[model samples]
Target: MSMREINFDGIVGPSHNYAGLSPGNLAATRNAGHVSHPRAAALQGLEKMRANLRLGLAQGVFLPQPRPDHAWLDRLHQRYDTASPHLKAQALSASPMWAANAATVSPAADTADGKCHLTVANLMTMPHRSHEWPDTLRQLRLAFASGAFAVHGPVPAPFGDEGAANHMRFAAEHGRAGVEVFVYGERGGPFPARQHREASEAVARAHRLDPARTLFVQQAEVAIAAGAFHNDVVAVANERVLFAHELAFEHRDAFYADLRRLMPEVEIVEVPDARVSLADAVSSYLFNAQLATLPDGGMALILPGEARANERVWTWLQELVAGNGPIRRLEVVDVRESMANGGGPACLRLRVVADPATVDPRFLVDEAKLDRIAEIVTAHWPEAIEPGAIGDPALIAQVEQARAELLRALDLVELLDS
Candidate 1:
């Protein structure tokens, strides 16, 4: 019925520590552009996301302040700057840029939201196991202790582990429910690093997260650059179960089968695919996710007449509402820019806190356009109309639908699941 807030997601680390020399990575660079500068590539990802999220607030995460404990990224960047053709080719062949860039995209919120929430990448800078996490965690914790949500990747490794778990536990203790841990991807970040995988699994176990939370997404394995994924996820600031499309396709049957087997009372919808590249997917997610809220009734509807790639976010939203899910208020808004990076209504958002129950809807309406919109839409398209005709339905619907579709085309879902 109404639209509000747009975010400019910032990017961080393309550090060598996360993604070092790998093979097959060269091709990804070529596919995106002709630059060896990983940071530039990361920027491309950020720009794409900015373009996709049309309706939410635009803000970005500042890069980690360079520090000794986090110096591995610096080393990697140094190497990338001076990488030998042989090494570069080898690294490129293996995968795209470094894995830590997965953490680059920073989450943002509206100025009025009252709290700062940050999304962090879960991958390690170096593959080596550690008794202690880098000091970056402590610094970040101290910096934004009062944040609304600190969304990050799984705490424990996929199968299970201790070191990262300790880091995650520390984060949890400091963060409380403000922390929402999500899984990266299925194949799991460049190269076949068994130790990293083991560590990730261990962290997951230590956190007592559902395996479904341990996403084996597609983008995490390839195109994602360190923090590129975070930008899109951080844009949204509402509470709802994030339904990842990549998860649905790669593991939907099992996820659903398991859900039915364990929590049958839960209703699920298989998110439809938007056939876009991974970078695009993250953008789409960030742009459209801001307006999402819990629905009011068992069958509240949130349908976008058109969105690219058949990304059925509106459909999923409808299903969630129909199931009487915890998400109670749903507001579908316009997102044209983020779709370029493969985002939709849900991809770009990062939920910081549930909205205050008594918040007024008048805040969302554009006072300047309300009367004019109502007059025009009511005069023309009635099928796509919202109650009371506060705004131009045809114009709003057309704009919103275009934004949603663009996100589906960009592969924001792939990035989200990853």
Candidate 2:
């Protein structure tokens, strides 16, 4: 069987809310305390998955880890009322809905060895997200236990790691060995640069990636301060094509030069400053798009609805797709529920390239599975959640019960207790 890239999107959790915990995330801080509709969010996600499947793209799904993570919080011995704001924020966060921050993946094709490798991110820079790796690893192992995959623990902390949000892979074909770009920031700006150079290197070593094939680049300081918290905020790549804002990297010339030297066939699709400023891109989330290779030998940009709402971005994208470019089509997905909390279409999913036989069968999905998931969401997920409700003990119990129903419905009961 041929290996292919599969987009594994995380289902929006029942506790999905706007805590505004992520410091550098533009969307999170901008829309703090907005009401969230859990049922609508999950249904929208399922519909997006169905849309991808209808387009003949390989789509996979992951269960959201139970939230207001009581087990992990219990270790600290602080009751809900006594917990500090940061601690409370950590417990109430729905940030896991943005699974791009979950881990960095290097497919078997890119690794020196033949086994696919995954490294869970520490996310140590943010109080709410720092506690995710432990629970995330538990689920990753449960779903990727096959011999074809290697799940590595998060890089030792004191070093921040933001995962695939800062990593991009490119090659002549989806299933072939590719050049992996690890974008890091040195924290020169006001907001912390989440992907530390040390963490990126650790992941590359864990995957046993060839030094020649792996390249490290620094994220633009301006981009970080302007809320391009992760590289995905300013860049995206699919196969041999990279769509990036000109200011995405600290040293743009050197970065592109390295790519040209290493991968001559690489196609550089830069959004120049003259066309659209970095500020507009961050505000519009123009770069937070899913770059998928269509079977027709063309590419498509799966953009968030917000992208269309932004006149500047929408105008540029319209011209780009209509012009002589690799990206020939556009699809807009409404992920406003999660998008309000600083995530977009790309943020909701993690792309893994491997054969169906290599991944745990439970993670794969079809039309039937989408219908079942939608039914569960409509039946059990909360219709609405408010920012102030995070403090309610009753809401916690409600979320816990809802997640239990979800686990049983998906036959992922192993994660229920986790």
Q: Candidate 2 lDDT, tens digit per residue, 1-418?
A: 5788899988898888777877788788888878888889888888888878877788888787767777768888877666776677688777777889889999888787789999999989887888888878987897789888999999987889989999999899988888999999986467988889999999999999999889999999998988899999999999989999988999999999999998999999999888889888987788999999877878889988888998888999999988998889999998887778888889999998888877777788999988888888888888988877877778778878888887788788888777
| CA lDDT of each prediction against the hidden true structure | 0.30, 0.86
Could you give candidate 1's per-residue lDDT for residues 86-118 as a string of tens digits?
A: 333322221111112222221222212334333
The candidate maximizing TM-score is 2
Candidate 1's displacement at residue 298, Å, is 12
Over 4 Å off in model 1, which ranges? Answer: 1-8, 11-28, 32-60, 64-70, 73-139, 146-197, 205-251, 260-267, 271-291, 294-418
- Model 2 ranges off by over 4 Å: 81-86
Best by lDDT: 2
